[model samples]
Target chain A: MINLLFLPLVIPLATAVACLLAWKNQGLQRIISLIGSFLLLIAAAVLLVTVQQDGVLSVQGGGWAAPFGITLVADLFSALMVCVAAGMGLVVAIYSLADTEAEYERLGYHPLMQVLMLGVCGSFLTGDIFNLYVWFETMLIASFVLLAMGGKRAQMEGAIKYVVLNLIASALFLAAVGILYGVAGTLNMADLARMLRESESSGPIPVIAILFFIAFGIKAAVFPLFFWLPASYHTAPMAVTTIFSALLTKVGVYALIRIFTLVFFAELAAWQPYVLAIAGLTMVIGVLGAVAQDEMRRLLSFHIVSQIGYLIMGLGLLTPLALGGAIYFMVHVIAAKSALFLATGMVLRLTGTTELKKLGGLYRHQPLLAGLFLVAALALAGIPPLSGFWAKLALIWSGLESGNHYLVVAVALLVSLLTLFSMTKIWAAAFWKGAVVNGATDTPLPLSRRVYWQMAVPTALLTATTVLIGLWPEPLYALCMDAARQLLVPDAYIFAVLGVQP
Target chain B: MSSIILSTTIRLLLPLLLLFSVFLLLRGHNEPGGGFVGGLVAAAAISLYALAEGVAAAHRILIVNPRQLIASGLLVALSSGVIPLMTGRPFQSGLWLPYSLPVLGHVGTPLLFDLGVYLLVAGMALLIVLSLMEEE
Candidate 1:
């Protein structure tokens, strides 16, 4: 029962310990990490199935119920997110085995990666706001270590900016949590949601909500607060960047969606317009920034900002369909974007640089790699029959159904085209053009079969998932719909966490 | 580089600081002092020793790796949660001994969990300090 909920958190933490113990043994560390990640995926899948069958599942810590103690709750949305996060964990662990240097392994890379997943799973599964903050700190600390591990000048620069900005974000979130607890006399999210609704006092509540909005906004990299993301994301190791792209910002978006829907449902009208405007600006600015980038990972990092804009846009529209679309978009983008980053990593591995100006002839040298990148890129641009297209269709249909946001709908279309343009720019420069005879391409050696499988297999696995989800999106869509239904009517979650009468 | 006065002062103060940290850790469950504060106190004591006796001496005193302490602490904390699951209870439930224990009275899983936190924080602080000292 509730033991099931603890598995995801426990597995990673246990693995992290094993990894630390195996610090001198890189091969053993990799094996343990892989097995742990595999177990996490299985646990998450089981949790999702259980929550799907049982509605919402909540477990109280130390037998203390509701507002009295910490809880771990897995509604459909959180469960799905956990499943996706674990999937990323597994893939990144595999990718790291091939890509990370031995020096990093000695410096506790595997353990930190495991701890990072632990924090992510904890964040997605926790039922208390303060617990969420703790999990955020856990994730941030692990990420800080991972980002700065190499101690290169570029890494130090990026890590400093990332560290400073995220510290500000954490402080804001903590301050807001303190104010919220003071106002509501509780730290449990369900209890606060209930209390915030019942008490007709909306004075400090709106101000508190604004603080939360800004806090999560910075984490989510929405419009005005996104400068830190592109600056730092490109500088991390490829495996590190892939996992960061997959889970970090999405956690922020998940927080926004969770709080806005559950706690701030009553105040949607006050915030909807602002959320919408931010979404639109985030989309425009992010893609425009991507278009101007010449480096592969930097451009992809900017695209992360733009895709986040779309996810937030669905929440802004505030309908079941739109929310469903947002959740669907989040999952699709996680898969597609991780695949793209892995592919970019492969390009960097082969060509020794991610600079579009220097990278070329990938199509000639590695057609499979080129094809996988194309699939992810096309999927990202919302091409037909891909996962992104269906996700966008759902959002746009919801937009039209809600009436008179024609401009927003048009902007969504424009962003997709711009996404297409930048992706094609990568394709043309990195794959289609003739080989660049430069310092970056000194030898141009082909990978061995083992090396190819170790590297390409993970990207191929992720790309195949994107294609599979694209071709048969019905099951995922249904899950998103169920998740959306739960968000729209949170009585199930509230009751699950706070009991029937609370 | 160290002064005899500094060394002598630390030799006298370190044991008291460590004793106070243990006192703080034991009283944490019902009082204001907890694992985090106690761990910081212990780390401060270690830092003081490092400053007085040089980092090489401090390293000899701390024979085990700080990373191992962290890992063990986390494992203990996670085990505290998982053990309750075996008895059909929720995570981290306060399972107690049927009889009162000698010296430390009425021991339970919450105390064990706090001990885990204590080790983790102390290890983390030591790791940072040792790494910084190494860099210098």
Candidate 2:
């Protein structure tokens, strides 16, 4: 069980080395990544089942006990995240297979992708804050490669900002870890939580908490800190943008959820309300940015920021129901967001453009594509019987239960309306127009089997997961409850780290 | 003639600069030196050579692109803390070697992590320098 925890991380990292060493062999690289991702998918499933049975699993390194050595632990939350990351990675692999990876051996996109996935999975499951920082830096390096692979004018320009901003964020994350390490004298989350629980009035506690909050805030694309995302995401290749849209910032949100629940729980009374305010404003501002965008990808980028506010809203509320909603919605958003980006990728491939002005009547011409896109879009807008809707209801119900009804209701209403407005623009400009497509007006080439298969499989799988989970959320709900419990207990994690059963 | 002298100076000084960078990285964790400082020193060495040679020529001599190096170095560094997962411990629980081979009885993942940091900083710092030099 313990070794399995490392598979999702190790396989990808190992595969990356192979890919680099075999850089000349594109087919080999593709096969290795596909197989490697599939193996991780299997590992994630195994982890899910184990967590369901045992609740939280911990592994100690070099035979050293907790607080003295590095530890990797998985609760239901981490396991669930591992599944999401591996599943999405598999889909992304299939998406990349249609293109040739051989022509650019020097850039090593294939290898970088593997390493990036390793970092994401590691961050999701790690119990140590310093370890998380290491993973964050790991992920950032791979991102630099993936972003700059094209080396075109736009890519180079965007990579400059992307690398610089991420570097600063990494530095801040390191600083937070240093501060936490210095104060806590231990990097283990469970121990820190226990310490924090014991020492409520400690002066540096809130300071360290605030530092972590802002560091993760930058990663999560909170309202004021989100300027870097929209500027750079639109510049990358559609495929790269799609994967980034799905995974990158969500990792930030994931960290926020992890740390707030674990190390900073005491700050809830004083600081959480402020978080709620930021959450509300982030939703409003993010959607407004989306509404103002004309480019399809840019529009979607802004929506990512907006949807993140919804996840943060749940955290701000700090109730089980709200957190559950947040978890469910994160899954929904991951599915819907990635699907929307891929659908856009298909549209771009078909039409060679992403500007909405140059795109119209896609629904009539490509009904299948339009259908998939609409499903994802509507799900994103929180329509009922969809994943987004269930997540919202849970959050709203939880918020209402806590006497924060007005805040929850108002924010939900405003954010959903704005979400609908932005989505409707997509519906109108891209799908609803009366058959006047600009790029291929006279003779549109039929969609290729490879392209259709490349996108359709992942889209169908995600859509089904969203719907199924929304309709019958018992399993995921139970999983999240268990995860939240593990996060709150702090003792289970601590005992696991220290090699003691107390 | 002046150009020849400049190129000769670059040729003579690059090795010394690189060696000094190693010294900084080796002494980093304990004695006021570390990865970031060492990385900058290495970048200075590379930039000096890049100035004498054309950007394209320097790129060939450097071999790997800085972006890829940054990515791989990061991966290396990240794996340092993460290897504990396989051993059933926390992500970065110090897997120490207790190396007492002829006086060096102190070693752990953090040192390896520092090495990763050194490589990443070197690659990242050089990437910027290379980009600017290319533009020039």
Candidate 3:
């Protein structure tokens, strides 16, 4: 029962180590790594069940006590993170098996992949404030490795900017922690929240929040701070970029939600409006960027920046419905975005180019793969009967209900249409035209299996999940409500930390 | 770039430093140290070796394989809490025992929890530093 929370952490970590130790045999490492991801998917499912029956689960360290030692908590929010993370990880791993086998052997690819999973899941589950910082660094480090994994000329060029930006973010995070510790005197989140309730930070809170936001903004790749993402994302291997595009930046967004809700709630009125503005700009700018791009992955990468605005917009709305909408959309986005990237990998594999000009008409040649791409793309565009529609519906409803009518209603409608526009560009550019069969060939295109065999299953599985949730969203909706409830009403969490009933 | 002099120093120090890091993690529950510090210490052990051994060798012997230790530690830490959750106590409520065997007898979830954190910090830090160095 209580074992579920730790499984997300354990399964991936062990698999990575085993892969590293036995990495000499690529076959053995791949099998073990796949098995590990499969096991984590199981673990994430069991965790959802546990959270269904139980509200929130906490683990005290070294068997000592809370408030003193670090803890890893699995509230509904955290559990959702585990499920999304593990689910995406499994999908990406499967997608990359064929996509990345050569790199897996000749370098440190397998180990880095495992470690990245560790960082991602850990960020989702940890209960401590400082622990969050550790997890962020954890993911950042893995991303650095992954970004520079291939050691190509462009990767090095892009990796430098990625490194400098994240390094500053990391330093700011450390300095913020020092202040948080200085002001609150505790690094544990629940304890700090409880402490913060008695008083709001005067001198340092805003500064710290900004610092934290900047750090996360850089990671999340928000409007102004997002330059690093497009610059570097296109340089990595298609598999690596796809995972980073789908998962990494969102980690920053996740932390933003965590801190703003728990520790920084006092400043919500002031910050929400600012966050709302950023969300709107992010969405608008992101779509515009996508519209201008000629490359499939780069355009999609820009879209990721914009869509995050949607998530942050929900946060700015700050109502339960809005917040739940954000969470739901997060799941939807993870599935849709990762699937889109994986589809790109398949396209890259077959066509030997991600350039919209060099390739076209993939739909006629690879029907199953094209179909998978359409479903994921439509989902990203918030079309009906897919998970994206429902998530958008919730955000819009929450917006109207809360009476932030203009930002929520008007911008929401505009973004949905724009999302459609950006997605259609990919549909038009990558799959619509007749197959070109270009002469700029290099390593030669792989003809191995049905694009769906290794690739389509993962993307289709996510798309199906999107559709299923769109069709009958009661269970997930209920779970998200419970998760949000646990977050908003902090008594249980506070009690978890202090054991005091006041 | 792959200097032998640095590698020899790392090789000479890896065992001793990691042993010290484990010491820091185990005793962190009651003292000034815990997962973060212990993790940093352990990560330091690995990163130091990475500088000395070349990124490839260091990745092989240390962090590349051992990041999973955190999860096992987390499981051990988390299971300590279930002892109470099953008995209708709140999540992570302490079941302390003031033992006859000096300080270590104070074994509880806090200690187990710290151990989990220690491993995670160590593994994660190593993950970042190693990956970055490899790129370099």
lDDT string, candidate 3, B15-102, tens digits: 8888888778777766777778878987888788777666777767863445455445555555665566666554566776666457
Q: Identify the runs in model 1 with alpha carbons over 4 angstroms from their true place.
A: A437-442, B2-20, B31-34, B44-53, B134-136
Question: Which ten-residue region of model 2 chain B has the weakest summed lDDT?
Answer: B98-107
lDDT of 2: 0.80
The better candidate by DockQ, 1 or 3, is 1
Instruction: Give per-residue lDDT, candidate 2, residue A126.
Output: 83
Q: What lDDT score goes with residue A57 in model 3?
A: 77
CA shift of B34, model 2, Å: 14
Q: After superposition, how far is residue A283 of candidate 1 from its true place, in Å?
A: 1.1
> Residue A365 lDDT in model 1?
73
- Give the per-residue lDDT digits (tens) of candidate 1, residues A1-502: 7679888888999999999877778899999999999999999999999999988999898888777877899999999999999999999988887889988888889999999999999999999999999999999999999999989999999999999999999999999999988888888989987887777846798888888989999989999999999999999899999999999999999999999898887676567877888898899999999999999999999999999989989999989999999999999999999999999998888878899988777787789999999999999999989999999999999989989777778888899999999999998999988878873554566766777678898999899988999999999999999999999889999999888643
- Measured with DockQ on alpha carbons, how good is candidate 2? 0.21
lDDT of 2 at A84: 92
Among the numbered candidates, top lDDT falls to: 1
Question: Which runs in model 3 stand beyond 4 Å of their true positions?
Answer: A437-446, A450-452, B1-136
TM-score of each: 0.96, 0.82, 0.82
Cα TM-score of candidate 3: 0.82
Q: By DockQ, who's the top model here?
A: 1
Restricted to chain B, the TM-score per model reads 0.95, 0.87, 0.79
Deviation of model 3 at B3, angstroms: 18
Q: What is the clash count for each candidate, in the order shown?
A: 0, 19, 29
